[model samples]
Target: MSQTPRYQEIRDDLLARMCDGTYPPGSLLPAEPELAEAYGVSRPTLRQAIQLLADAGYVEKRRRRGTVVRRRKVEQRFMDALMSYGADVEAQGAIPATRVLQARIQGASPEVAEALGIGEGDPVASLMRLRYLDEEPAVLLRTWVPTSVFPGLLGHDFEREGLYDVFAESGLPVETVRRVLEAALPDPVEAELLAIDEGQPCFLFKSVGRAKTGQAVEYSVALYRGDVNTFTVTLTTED
Candidate 1:
C-alpha cells in the first residue's frame, strides 16, 4: 500500500497535538526549521502542513510571533433564540462592552420603512452602536425603530443597557426576528468603524424584528468581523 502523504501526516499530527493541548491557544509553535527537522520533512512540506492549519483557522502567522494558535471563534446562534451580543460574548468568558456611536430621530428611508412596515418619511429612532469583545471592536450595529412604537428611545443610555433590554422595558419586546446574512466586503466607512482593513470580508446581517402581536417594530443592519466571529445554525432532518 502507498504511504500517507508526508504533508498530510504532519498536519494530522499537529492537529492531534493541538487537540490534546500541547499547542494551546495563543501559544506559539516551534520554529519552522525545528518543526521541519523534528517531523523529518523538508521546510516546504512543514509549511504546507502549517498552511493547512492556518486555512482552517487553527493558527496565525505573524511577522515577529511566528505561528500562534488562535482562540476559538465566537459562535453566534442567531437562529436558535434571541440573544444579545453582550450575552453571547459573556458566555464565552470574554468581556462585552458597547459604545453608542449615534442616536437620533430621523425620517425612515424606503428600505427602512419597508422593513419596519412604516410609511416613508415617518419618524424613526435611529441608533448606531459599536460592540466590543474583550476590548476588540467586533460589530457595528445600526437599528431603527418606529417612533410611534417606542417614543423617547433615544434618551435611554444604550452604552450601558442592551437594545433588547431597553425595548423589553418599554413594553415593545422583539418576539421574533427574520434575518438575512450575506458575505460582504466592508466599505471605507465600515472599515474605519470596525478598525479593519478596507475591503476586508465581513458578515452583513440585515434583520426585521417583530413584536409578539406580529407588528414589525425594528429594522437593523449589523456588520460582524469575519476573522473572530462565526455564525452557526442547527438543521435537522428526520430519517
Candidate 2:
C-alpha cells in the first residue's frame, strides 16, 4: 500500500486522540507549535492537519482558544417534513433561537427572481438571520419572499418567529420545494457572522418553495456550520 501522506498521518493521530477522550469535546488541543514539534512537522504542515480535522467536523479553530474538539454534529435529515430551523433543532433535543440581522423590502436579484418566478428587480421581502442551536452559532439563513405574495412581510418580527410560520400566517401554503445542497468555504462575511475561522467549510442549502397553484412563495439559502451540522438523506427502493 502507498504510504499515507504526512499530513494525513498527523490528522489521523489527532483524530485518534479525540476519539479516545485524550482531547474531549469542547476541550482545546495543544498549541500549534507544540503539536508541530511533537509531530516533527512544519507549522504549515501542522496547520494542514488541523484544517483537515476542522473540515471533517471533528474540531474547530477558534481565535485565542486554539483548536477545540467539537461536539458531535447535529443531524438534519432531509427526508423529514419541511419545518423551521427552530423546529428541527428542537426535535433533536437542542434549543433553537434566532437573531434577525436584516429584514426589509428590496429588489430581487436575478437568482432570487428566477427562484421565485418573478421579474428581476421586483419587490421582495428579504430577511437575514443568524440561527443558534444550544446558544452556539449554527446557521446563517437568508430568505426572500415576493411582496406580491405577502404584503407587509417586513412588519413582522422574525427574530422570535420563523419564516415558515410567517408564510402560514399569510395563508400561503407551500406545495412543493426543490433544494440543492453543496459544500463551500465561508466568505469573510459569513465567517464573521458564524464565528468560525475564515475559509472553514460550510454546508450550503438553497431552495425554492412554491404555493399550491404553482406560484413561487419563497427563495431561501442557508449556510450550516460544517463543524456542528451534518445532513442525512434517506433513499428507498421500490418493491
lDDT of each candidate versus the true structure: 0.88, 0.86
Cα error, candidate 2, residue 114 (Å):
1.1
* lDDT of candidate model 2 versus the reference: 0.86
What is the lDDT, from 0 to 100, of the residue 101 in candidate 2? 92
Model 2 TM-score (2 dp): 0.76
| Model 1 agreement with the true structure over 1-239: per-residue lDDT tens digits | 99988998999999999999999766789999999999998999999999999998898876645897776678887767899887887888878899999999999999999998889999999999999876778899999999999988888899998888988988889999999999988898988887667656899999999989999989999999887798888888999
lDDT against true structure, model 1? 0.88
Q: Candidate 1 — which residues are off by over 4 angstroms?
A: 1-70
Task: Point to the candidate with the largest lDDT.
Answer: 1
**How do all models score by TM-score?**
0.74, 0.76
Q: lDDT (0-100) at residue 238 of candidate 2?
A: 95
lDDT for 24 in candidate 1 is 76
